[model samples]
Target: MATKPRMHLALDFSWTQVETDWRQPTSWVNRFYPDIGLFEDVARICERGLFDLIFFGDSTGIPNTWEGRIDAAVRRGVAWPRMDMSPWITAMSRVTSHVGFGLTYASTFMHPYYTARLLNALDHVTNGRIAFNVITSQRKADFQNYGYDELVEHGERYDRMEEFVDVCKKLWASVDPDAFVWDPVSGIVADPAKVRPINHVGRFFKVKGPLSVPPSPQGRPVLVQAGGSPRGVRASARFVDHVFGAGKGLALMAEQRVKLDEALRAEGRDPQQVGILWATKVIVAETEAEALRLKERLIADVPMEAVGAWLSHNTGFDMSTLPPRFSLRALNQRIVAANASPVGFVGLLAEQYGEDMEISRDEFFRHGLHAATGYASTKAGTPVQIADYLEEMFEATGSRGGFMLGHSQAGHRAVLQNITTMLVPALQRRGRMRTAYEGRTLRENLAAS
Candidate 1:
């Protein structure tokens, strides 16, 4: 018999207004600092349900994907006008006793020494309630800050990432977990024998460390990886605690799982030790029809241009190059078939809704992010149906859970209310979510081997 599933329901707090009511714009601005009271509310809700974590997602560079300007992204409340996710995590820690904080930094952007320290500090502050998403972003402009005129080829970037992760891990392990005693009488703090420099030299970087930061709870904030490429799967299989993706459907997700399984086996890992979370959206109402109605309201405030730009960024191509007749095969051939299935889906969406998406660039900017690239779901009328759908989703994808919401910078409360009031109860009743946290610290709750 399948035991109840334990879900880690993290809110993407849209950080902006989600509705077209136009009465409240910029609701998302507050999540940057995450008003202490509101954050405390989220922590309370998640902890009440024993949710594994409540983390924030961030992009290192601007979301200026369309026509190379930030206006379209800003207008639609896509992702342009957001605040740094790091500071916000401290707020999350201050307010919550549990619910691990997922903060992100790209391997391609930040140096390992600095990146490692921030995570260690936060881990110390959170008492082990921290998770880090390692990313390689699509923004070419971010390269300017990294001293590059252009982004490295994806293959090279990931190859370098392998070294990056290795270095970070070595730095973490180099400092034994029990190295610090702070013995005042003996005038000893850390045993020099326990703390040694990790001499890391590779294709991308070389750092002699002794990571500058002291180790904290969960050893290192549990590592999480988000990318769907073949290389991404391989890299993550070796190192990450969680892998996040937009599972296209049951069949595709199953196929992807098989690939992930093989990767894990090759790396000599127990596949069960690595967790997967799919990007998902849900609408729940007192009744099923009511839920569908709620969804219709959501799509209206969308910016289609943002969706197009998202598709382009997925494949690192220009949206203008996407034609109505653009088939997956043709598009794949354009990139010499080095494309991921993510690109193929863009081809599918463009072929399916090109006419509706072909508005002025500004008009389309915020239209489609809500048009999920992953699972499309709705649950109306009663909690039973919601539980049934969640069960079905898990059965279909072989994922432990779903990344159930988005555009959080647009509205945090809507997501909080949904998971707390609707989703969590539904899953709990069905025996799919944890009834209470089984262990202490965020990692014990989420990363059980």
Candidate 2:
């Protein structure tokens, strides 16, 4: 059986417009801090779509890589004023039963014990309806915020993350699930004998004892990772339950799946164990022509400066500093050499234009600048047309993990509303999506497809 495909809402990217456009009447994010209204409504919408989970990919600091300045990022809301998503996950879980929540946390700077305790408590709070999107932080400002002089090299960070996750796992297992036996007759709460110290001494992290919190309903938070580099793929194969992917289209995603499966087999693990959910942007409407028109409108609204800022932030290169003659392929080479962060879709640009093909400055601007317009892997169609595209991708990639859609126009609410009310029902009618969740815990629900 083709594991009934799974779907999740990529909140971080989708919610980007909220801050800039929040004052607009259609904006979902009414305010910045304590986004109670925004989150609750999003949770209900995702739940109605029968989404397996709603996830946020977060960062810790204000990015300043663009033009060697933080002004653009801060002003444009390019991942600035970042809020800790942990609190919102708990709040969302309160209103929904089965839709899971995944929160990103960097393994680079955080102590293993703290990570273990925090997520364990959340797992309990959500009744195991939680996943941790483990990320290896590479942003220089993020490192500086944590009292580090510089960010570690990419490979070394993942190495440390491996040990970080190891220590956390041991701490989570420090207290046995069956150890807690509430016996009012003898006034005993837990079996002390069953609890033992992990005493994990690792290369990157050292933890002394058992976690104070008891075991969560799902034992441990599901591990979600998004690492595209070779070392990253290997690390994910060893530990991750879900791997987030980004590509330009279904063909590229299928290619990535092949690579991920190879990594899993190399690690002596079954390829089926890890789900590959490609990060995608989707636009849907009552008709295909209307969706195309919406895409065009969205493209026109995107500020090119925001694109440059985002690219600079991600690649650690000031777009303005580069020579005017620089080609997109050249930029990719520079990023690959720096190992600053995942090159992501930019790396795949070479596939479209042959390696030797030169994408001129204007050509590069035409494609790269509109990334914020939400067109990468973007499908524009009616409900059935969108459903058909999703089904085709599922069949092509053999994606047991399914898709993570980040609606670029999420602030409009209409896009999200159409998805839950129109696209989802279309999928269900075709038996491509679930009518209801099959499991109680997020882990179980995830295991379903």
Candidate 3:
């Protein structure tokens, strides 16, 4: 008998609007504070709905990488100057009962020691309701901000991540769970026996062991990373518990999922352990037409120039440098990678686009691959429509789950309303997903049947 699938919602909220509009910081995202209004509403709603974790995505680099202008990046509201998501997530932890928070930051650029200490502190602050979305920083311009001559090549960047993640793991392990025990009778806040120095030496990093903070809830916050290149698969295979991706169709994404798992085991890691999650967007309404109308309005509201900037920064190529026809067969492999053997970098150009290699790269860009719009008809009509599509997605990919929702207006609130009121109940009727959280921490939720 087939066991039912478990669905977990991960939010990329806060600075969630990657829309290439909204020039001012005030316009970027309303109420950056997590303890206050919208975020609070979002938290309470998701908690009631029993979401596993809602991830807070923050990019160190601007969307201005393509055009070399911060102005366009700022106007579009694409990951601009932002508050550290960790502190805000701590605020959410104070309010919510279950639901963990996954905070995203770059693994490629930042020093691993700082990453370890910061994440460990968040783990303490959130009482273990935290996870890390390990990322190889995106912008070529970010390297310049940190005073580097150029962006590290793709393969080299993943190599750095391998070392960086190792260092973080060691740092997390350094402070034993039994290290801190306050007792006034004997007078010992922490045991000296528990302090283990890391003294780790690697090609990219060197850290003396033992993090200062002790374990709080989960042994170590769950490690999460998004799908990038094939080298990304190898990196994720070794470290990520959940891998996030976005695409236009479930079938296309399912194909990607298979490739990811194969890459995982090829790297000698158990592919089954790593969950392949599709990064997606689903705008729901009481009616299918209503949803379509709303989507059209949102797309129109987005400025073409802003979208152009997003495209440039993301693909890491100046649109002016290459038209639609130039085969992007080769990216700076130090950064971008080919999928499977002789596979076009599906992370950039899905294999579908490569059949006509002579097609303009610009033409290929318009195919809606970066965005996992999902569904052939572009409609998740009624509660049943959404549920049916979600189930099909799981069946197609053999994925434990698919990731939908992110930081935006009513990010969690909107999703929870849709899930609890419409989606979840619909799935429950069909015998997929869960009615409640399985555990108190993020990992527990991910593992819960």
Q: Pick the candidate with the highest lDDT.
A: 2
Candidate 3, residue 276: how far the Cα is off, in Å? 1.8
Root-mean-square deviation of each candidate, in angstroms?
Answer: 4.3, 2.4, 4.2
In candidate 3, what residue range of length 10 has the lowest lDDT sum? Answer: 338-347
* 190 Cα displacement, candidate 1 (Å): 1.7
Q: State which candidate, 1 or 3, has the greater lDDT.
A: 3
Question: What ranges in model 3 sit over 4 Å off?
Answer: 1-3, 18-35, 266-269, 324-350, 355-379, 406-416
Across residues 64-160, which tens digit of lDDT does each residue of candidate 2 receive? Answer: 7777678888777776666788897888899988888888889998888888899999998988888888989867667778997756788889999
Q: Which is superior by lDDT, 2 or 3?
A: 2
Error of 2 at 87 (Å): 1.1
TM-score of each: 0.85, 0.93, 0.85
lDDT for each candidate structure:
0.63, 0.75, 0.63
Instruction: List model 1 lDDT by residue over 1-449, tens digit each.
Output: 86655555555443333223122332333453335565566666667656676656666455454565655555654444446666766776786777787787778878887788888888898888888888776564455557776556777667777778888888888899889989999998888899999888787788989976667878887888776778788988888787776545666667777788899899999887777776555655567676565555544534466566555544445554555444444555554333223334454445445523544333333323444322133334445776676667677666564553443212435534665677678887766776676667877887542
On the 0 to 100 scale, the lDDT of residue 49 in model 2 is 76
Q: What digit string (tens of lDDT, one per residue) describes model 3 on residues 1-449?
A: 78776666765564543452132233323444323555666677777766777777665666555556777767655556556666667777888878778888787678888888888788777767788888776566566667865566667777888889888887888777888889989898998888889899888887886777776578887998875556777778778888877544666677678888788777787766677656555656678886665444334444545555655555555444445455545433322431112222333353555533555554544442223112222343567777777777777887565565533223323434765567667777776767777676777778765
Worst 10 residues of 1 by lDDT: 15-24
Question: Any runs in candidate 2 off by more than 4 Å, and if so which?
Answer: 1-15, 18-25, 30-34
